[model samples]
Target: MSLVIDIHTHPAFFEAINADEERLHLRQTCLGLYKTGAAPLAHIFNQMKYAGIDRLGLLPLDLTTTHGVELVSNAEIHHLVSLAPEKFIGFASVDPRRKDAVEVLEYAFGELKLSGLKLHPAKQKFYPMDEGLDAVYACCLRHNKPILFHAGISLQPDAPSQYARPEHFEAVALRYPRLRMCLGHFGWPWVVETAALLLKYPNVYADTGLLYFDSAREFYQHVFTRTLGQHWVDRSLRHQVLFGSNNPRFEQIRMVEALHTLGWRASTLELVLGGNALEFLG
Candidate 1:
């Protein structure tokens, strides 16, 4: 199927080299496009092509100050989006802990006109229901933008991720009924919970971005079919589940095989391929 949109990705911004070579410099400046062969893995265009993904949902991680140090900034994300307007969709990341969290959202959406937001509760050191972020949600709601939340239980240990649970988002969903919310990685361990949210809420959606092979695939299949129901596949093929290649993580073909094995209809497969993103992004 022909693909025109991809709902998730992180295209590295061109980083500036510094003499320090310390953590600060390495984390902040050692990025952007590399002069390696054709397109650099961090480059949006190249990453898109390498994964057979076209347009992308660009997520810049800026929260989790300590943990999300390598997280990209809204400024860099906006620049990349502007560089190739036809190939990318921008989503801003704001540290909900910052007093200027709402202001950050303003700059990204109100000023840059970005279409979405990436909220990482772990990196931000807050819960999805953190009162500090009420205004941030309000700002996105006021602007009518969607939010791609890095949700579900944490897979890593000693990781400072507090808002990985899918249930944490229920209040946000109930509060902002019109705000389009997508669970990155389909809420993983909480697929059943995430599936329930999708069933209960109109504004909720999921993406097939980073799920890998073997056991992970089987677990996802079981939940998608067992919990979401056999008919769930038919229902979500078009717009509910989106396709994403979490770069530097999983290959495109690997995700493709898993999605195809579900035996989805041609239209639904086409939607998961890219149609869903186009509808949401375009």
Candidate 2:
């Protein structure tokens, strides 16, 4: 098998949170994750070994301004990466609405050595095309860091779906053609719109972190085969698709199995699994 990478994972439930109350707070804030347990960091490594995932992108969510909390701090993510640098890729999150958002990003990219940025428009209650975020976008462009966005529906109780619609990102893509951005979860149920962005902008990408209903295989079949054409990924956007499990909400092992069962060419599978992610992270 080619090197597999799960590009969307929230490490909020790791053992770093020693207190039970803190863990409960994290679970409540991250909504729709009622059954996931806080486990030791080694548990993630074991899961990766079983799932054939060679590496993982550790994404933290900074909701300081809106939620008055950080799901997992950049410093925490940096600590995790320091423990296992070869297996973990860290991405920093900042409340773009903050006045010093650009400065925070610069420190994350330059000092913390985080690879990219992760943002959630719905949870943060901000529009993707808002002029307020131009500085954050410019900072990312200057540092050559990719931004991974939660572009579809969000499960947070206070999260508004209106903020995450795929079309809202069009302006960002058009304005910053040099900045690389990914709409995570394939932007479903707006998969077609997400695919349109992928087809139109070389700088835009999407990840297969979608597992909203049924089994992973069933959901993926419905989205990829029925919604988008069967060959759309391999033929039209092979290099732009990244495999993401959105772990704990879903399982990396099951998603990997589901993607392999889709009947895509071996080369296409390789790209979606890891090759495309490498290019996106560049």
Candidate 3:
């Protein structure tokens, strides 16, 4: 059987919901927006089981200063990874603005034993190429762990969307030539720039996240045939494409189905569904 990995997810976003009283009031919080298909840990696993997701890249957001939501901490992610080592791959998050951010990242990798790093530049309010992150990038390069960056627009009210554009990644891509970086959301409306980066930098990649929200045909036309063209999409897929559900915001099974609607050949389908992720995360 082919393996499937979801490289982006906010499983611990609503960690407070685990509390009895908070669970009852979950409908009132910002997380309540996902009340429809989103469920507790057990139900989330059930969904993954039904969707044939063998593994997931569980990401914790460190938006403490920006959104006052530090619910998903590195410790929480570590606990989850420890609980289900075979199913969950923890990706630690650290606000680059913090004084000891580099130390925290070192602790996450050396002590916590996390697999990778996930950053939301928009919420974190920093550019991907910010010189302050050089230490963090160097640490990632030393550990050989990939970094998933939130690109394009952000939903956070505190975010200055300008900080998250795909073009901004070029500087980092050029500086850390061997550092593996996956631009999340395929940079959405900036898919062209995302595609260009994928072509220009051997270590740069992207995931199909919110882009699948549109119909398969529309998505295909806009991303592949219309904007970047079929040839560009095909080449990029062979090298840098990875499947992602952006779960809780969207269903995993539905995202899988959406990829099938694109009508890629058997080999390409296997790669996009899981093969690329295995390589990227390695």
Candidate 4:
């Protein structure tokens, strides 16, 4: 089988602290990271082995000092990725409001040799399309790096304003068409809208990170059999969708199984499994 690449997962640490009821949330979130087989700096390799996630992007999320979401520091993420170079891909998270935002980007790209950058507007407390992001995008463009932005749902129960709609990225993409942007979770609520944007900006693409794997398969199955005919699978076979298990939320291998159960065309399956990611990240 071709290697399975989960484009959006955090093999590195999460906000392990700062929960109101740390003891309880740890029962799920922190301890749950362990259940997902995600680990801190030291155990990443073993976790990857146990989880059978051929490749995982050690994604990080940042907080803006206001919303008390315990966010991971980019420094910690850089250290983790440096320890195990190949099994992981690091996307350094940044606080757009940080006075040293540009400096952080340089350190991450130049010194750490990380793969990309991750931004969560909801968590970072800024609009992805806000003019504040212009310089950041220019920096990424200069280095030819991609960005993974949380465009769909808020992973936390913080203030509602934390959630940003997918179109929030339209301005940025339109302005910096040269910069690559990967919408995590396929920008769910705006999944179709995201797809439309991809047509205009080829630099934009997304992966099926946390899209309820089985449900995704069934949905696609319906599209294949009912709406688009039996060849639908063959037709969408070339689309840019890639399979990803959100780890702590769901297991990786289950995603692999879901695709197989849907009877996705072999070539298409290979593409979604890892082929597309390899090329996209290239």
Question: Top model by TM-score, which number?
Answer: 2
lDDT of predicted model 1: 0.67
Query: Judged by lDDT, which candidate is best?
Result: 2
Per-residue lDDT of candidate 3, residues 1-282 (tens digit) = 589888988774434334544533432254333344325677667878888888999988776666565546798889888878998889999888778788888999999999999998987889898899998899899899899999987654556679999999999999998899999988877998898888889899898876544764466556756677766656555668888877766656777776766656777878877888888888
Model 1 per-residue lDDT at 185 = 76
Candidate 3 Cα errors over 4 Å, as ranges: 13-17, 20-38, 212-222
In angstroms, give how far residue 123 of model 4 lies from its true place. Answer: 1.7
User: Residue 112 lDDT in model 2?
Assistant: 100
lDDT of each: 0.67, 0.90, 0.78, 0.66
Mind giving the per-residue lDDT tens digits that candidate 4 earns over 1-282? 688788887543343322234433433453234333323444545556664667887776666455434355566667666666676677887788877788888888898887888887765668887777888888888888888877777554442433567787788888887787877766765666666666667777677665443564575454334543465434643456666666656555555565676666788878877887776675
Put down candidate 1 lDDT per residue, 167-187, tens digits, no spaces.
Answer: 888998898888888887777
lDDT of 2 by residue, 1-282 (tens): 677889999887887653567656666556657766777878889999999999999998888898777778899899989989999999999999887788889999999999999999998999999999999999998999999999889876888889999999999999999999999999988999999999999999999999989998898898988889999998989999999989878767989999988879999999999999999999
TM-score of 2: 0.97
Between candidates 2 and 4, name the one with more favorable TM-score: 2
Report clash pairs, candidate 3: none
Q: After superposing candidate 1, which stretches have Cα over 4 Å from the reference?
A: 13-47, 64-70, 155-162, 212-223, 226-228, 236-238
Worst 10 residues of 3 by lDDT: 23-32
Count of backbone clashes for each model?
5, 0, 0, 0
lDDT of 2: 0.90
Candidate 4's C-alpha lDDT? 0.66
